[model samples]
Target: METSDLAALTDRARRLGADGRRRVLGIAGAPGAGKSTLAARITEGLQGRAVLVPMDGFHLAGAELERLGRADRKGAPDTFDAAGYVALLRRLRHPEGQEPVYAPAFDRALEEPVAGSVRVPADVPLVVTEGNYLLLDEGPWAPVRGLLDEAWFLDADPGLRVSRLVERHVRFGKPRPYAERWVAGSDERNARLVERHRARADLVVRLG
Candidate 1:
């Protein structure tokens, strides 16, 4: 993406008050595309004005996945509670005259989604949610796009993404061969599905 677009994106977030009533900013991309990193950077720059509500927080609990016999398909789009994620987004978009809406957060240490771990306070505006399927228009994820005020799709070199996946898996205790296999079989599939939604984004962010 051009430098002017990032400036505009940041400006848009800046214009939203810290009152949790403004529209949300969505960033969608395939696995290892730096959605989280970009989201974190933007929110961090705001210094508490923006909060990141990542889609990974909606990942099905490990135990639930095992029970459903889909633990092997962890990164698959269907593996997540897409409907629940949409519901949460709806609530965030329109916070009722109540305390606030709290969503789950995925704990990397536990490899599970912990309920009520992220509290989107009633006063914090500019929700920066990033995920692979935000721009995807199918199934439960279809409703997600309409809820977002604006969205960006991140593009990166495929080789860089593959390398990042391999290192990620290795950090999680998998051998190099197994890491490569997981990246090829699981992550790659998710990446392909995510690519189909790139056209739905408002801007294309190419990571340099």
Candidate 2:
């Protein structure tokens, strides 16, 4: 992405919250497609008008995943608390009081979610949430799209995406060989599933 593109996106995001009536902007994309990067940039551009509430915070605990026998496929759609995420979005959409709403954050180093790591002020006008399954239409995920005032789907070169995933895994303590295998298997599968919902986005951003 170029500087000008980010400026334009920032300007656009600014307008989404201009009315001061809380708006939820969602960023959805396959792993390594830059959803979080873009979301954080857009939020930063808003200059305190927005708060980021990532979907990764809803990820099931490692213990829960192990008990459910889904530990082997950690990034799958079912491994997250989809309903809980949706509920939080709804709360953000219509905040009832002055108290800031607390949100969970994913701790990459620990590979788990830390509760109350994010505080969303009730008065903030925009909430930017990003994740892999925001655009998914199955089960509890179906309501996610409707809750968003606008959604952007990010796209990038497949090879680059996979390479980024591998690097990220390795950075987080996975051996390079094991990272490659996980990206090729579990992560790639989730990426394909995410691709199916590209057409549902309000905008499709192709990252350079």
- Name the best candidate (by TM-score): 2
The total number of steric clashes, by the backbone 3 Å criterion, in model 1 comes to 3
Task: Look at candidate 1 and give me any clashing residue pairs.
Answer: 1-206, 20-124, 20-125
Candidate 2's C-alpha runs over 4 A off are 1-4
Mind giving the per-residue lDDT tens digits that candidate 1 earns over 129-195? 9998998888888999999988888887899988988998788778999989989999999999999
Name the regions of candidate 1 deviating beyond 4 angstroms: 1-8, 16-20
Reference-based lDDT, each prediction: 0.85, 0.92
What lDDT does candidate 2 reach at residue 171? 92
Q: Which ten residues in a row have the lowest lDDT in candidate 2?
A: 1-10
Cα RMSD, each candidate: 2.0, 1.8
Query: What RMSD does model 2 have?
Result: 1.8
Report the C-alpha displacement of residue 157, candidate 1, in angstroms: 1.1
> Per-candidate TM vs. native?
0.92, 0.97
